[model samples]
Target: MSKDQTRRRILEAAGPVFAEKGYDAATVREICSRAGVNLAAVNYYFGSKEQLYVETLQYGRDPEGQHDQPLTWPADAAPEDKLRLFIEGLVRQMLGERAPWHRQLMLREILQPTGACRQLVERHFRARMDQLLGILDEILPPEVPLSRRQQIAFSIVGQALYYRVASEIVKFLVDEDQRQAHFGVDQLAAHILDFSLAALGLHPGLAVPRPEVTHEPLEP
Candidate 1:
């Protein structure tokens, strides 16, 4: 395999192993064996198992880069409109049908953070939070305390997470067809938008809905 292909193979293999066994129990040998590469390949591509784990977190964040950046809104878009788009995108990123390891590895890190957590936070999570915080600024009054703004930001984010993190429980509670139609990206996005608006004391009934914008590819 080419170097890039070899590196990708390693990451793809590592994601599931680390997610399943976690950082401490997962071994370099198992990852290499799964990737179909030599033992040295891990060191060659990622330096160490710990570094490999961190890069795998990046891959899980968006190997496809579907959710790498915050949603783009037109300059003249309403704050409510902007917030809706952001929530939809966030929900889709979290719950959209994609690789299992994408969420599995992330949840592992969250529940049992390792050396990789800090880098993942610095590289991915913080930037996404800043984007949400920017959206909150437009709708929120200036007098809102910074601490309160952060709480609000996390509240919005937490809603998106609930669908993914607790997805099994959700599936158990709803019929399969009900789960399919209601939990779809577009529907969930609208629900979160209306729910969040109501929580913020904005009238969801008064907000105008616009066509959801198609996502542009992540920046290279």
Candidate 2:
């Protein structure tokens, strides 16, 4: 295989392994086996298992190659539009099926951080947080304290993440037939956008369906 192809294969294989077993429990031999490459390939490319694990985390963070795309919208896009886009992106990153390890690895880090945690935060988490905070600054009044703005940004992120982190509970609480309709990523994103806008005292301009009238008597 070409040098770049080999590196990509190793990274793709390593992501799920690290996510499944974490850095300490995951083995370089297993990653090599999964990638169909010799053990020396890892050492040659990344120099160490720890370095490989960090690159895997970085790959998981941007599996869709979003970094290659324009990182932000046009300068004239409304703040609300940017906020909606941010929320939707978060929902997709957290729950999208195309790269399950992205969420799994993040959860693993949260439960038990390792040497890789610092690099992951510096490379991915902090940058994303700063972007969200910048968007929040535009939406919130200038008089609002930075601390309050940070809290609001966290609030929006927390609301979106709850659906991902507590998804099993959400599935249990939701009716089986309604699960996909209600809890799908796009649906969750819309709900979060509407809910957040409402909380901010801004209308999302999406119509809300009124409750259906029923002639059935109430249960005792």
Candidate 3:
């Protein structure tokens, strides 16, 4: 294989290995064996196993290095539209539209951070978090504190992640028919958007109306 092809192959192979075993447990020999490349190729191309792990993460997150696509929107787009897009992108990523290993590796990092974890956050997640916070700033009232805004941002992301983190539980809780109907990317995104907007007092019409309760005295 050509140099670029060889490197790409290693990265592709490394992503799943590192994702499954994490940085410490994963080995270069296994990665090279999986890639069908010589063991020396990893050291030559990525310099070290740690560096290879970092690059594998980058490849898994965005193989093309297309950083601008997800957060990009028309300048004149409404905050609500931006928020919808953000939630959709997040839900899609969590649902493995990007790739299953991408989410799996990220979840592993969050749960058990390593030396490369900071780099992952700084390179990939910080920009996304900033974008989400900016959207929340537009939607939430000015009086809302930054701390509270941060909480709201985490809440929004948590709702999307719940479907992925508890996928089996979700399957057990939601029948296949209901899952097929309402748990799709678009449906879940729309639900989260409407739910968030209503909570922020921005889209009261989208909120589900609560059933009226009657209080009647019972005769003895």
Candidate 4:
């Protein structure tokens, strides 16, 4: 393989290992084996396991580094629209069918932060957080403190993440029929958007229609 190909292979192989085992327990030997490269390749290419771990995380989050930059919206777009798009994008990124290890690695880092956590936050998460906070600033009143706005931002993200982190619990709480009907990506996104907008006084709360019930006469 070419030099770039070798590096890419190692990264691809490393993400799932680190995500499943975490930094401390994951071995460079195993990563190299999975990549189908000699063990020396890791040391030669990455210099050390620590550096490899950091780069592995970066690769998982965004191999091209495109996500480090803020996303653009049309100049005339309404703040509510911007917020809806942001929420929908976040929900899809978490819940969409993609590499499972990507979200798993990120979630592991968040729950059990390591030395490399700072780099992940700086490179991948900072811009996204700023974007969400900017949206919240527009919808929330000026009287709302920055701290409160930050909390709101966390709340919005937490709602989306709950479906992933607590996926099993969600399945248990919501039956298959209900999940199939109301738990689709677009459905969840719209519900979250409407619920948030209503809470912020941007729109009226959603009114879910009650299901019809049939009754039999006691005599019959």
lDDT of 3 by residue, 86-201 (tens): 99888888785556687678777776777675876566667788999998877777999999998999989999889877899999999999989788988888888888887777
Clash tally for model 2: 0
Q: Using TM-score as the measure, name the better of candidate 1 and candidate 2.
A: 2
Backbone clashes under 3 angstroms, per model: 0, 0, 0, 0
Candidate 1, 1-220: lDDT as tens digits: 6879999999999988987788899999999999999999999888988889878888877787677444688978988888988898788778766647756676566656675567765556677778888888899999999999999998898888898778889989999998887778888888888788988988644355535646658679
Give the candidate number with the greatest lDDT: 3
**Candidate 1 deviant stretches above 4 angstroms:** 1-8, 19-21, 24-27, 43-47, 58-68, 99-104, 204-220
Ranking by lDDT: 3, 4, 1, 2
Q: What is the lDDT of residue 193 in candidate 3?
A: 87
Q: What is the C-alpha lDDT profile of model 2 across 94-124, one tens digit per residue?
A: 7877747866787677657785657765555
TM-score of 1: 0.75
Cα deviation in Å at residue 167, candidate 3?
1.0
Q: Which candidate number maximizes TM-score?
A: 4
| Worst lDDT 10-window in candidate 3 | 207-216
Q: Model 4 scores what on Cα lDDT?
A: 0.82
> What is the TM-score of each predicted model, taking all chains together?
0.75, 0.77, 0.79, 0.81
* Tens-digit lDDT string for candidate 4 (1-220): 6899999999999999997798889999899999999999988999989889888877867878665334578857899999988988888876886646876777677777786658765655767898898888777779999899988888888888888778899999999999998899999998888778877878755564324424536564
- In angstroms, the error of model 1 at 2 is 6.0
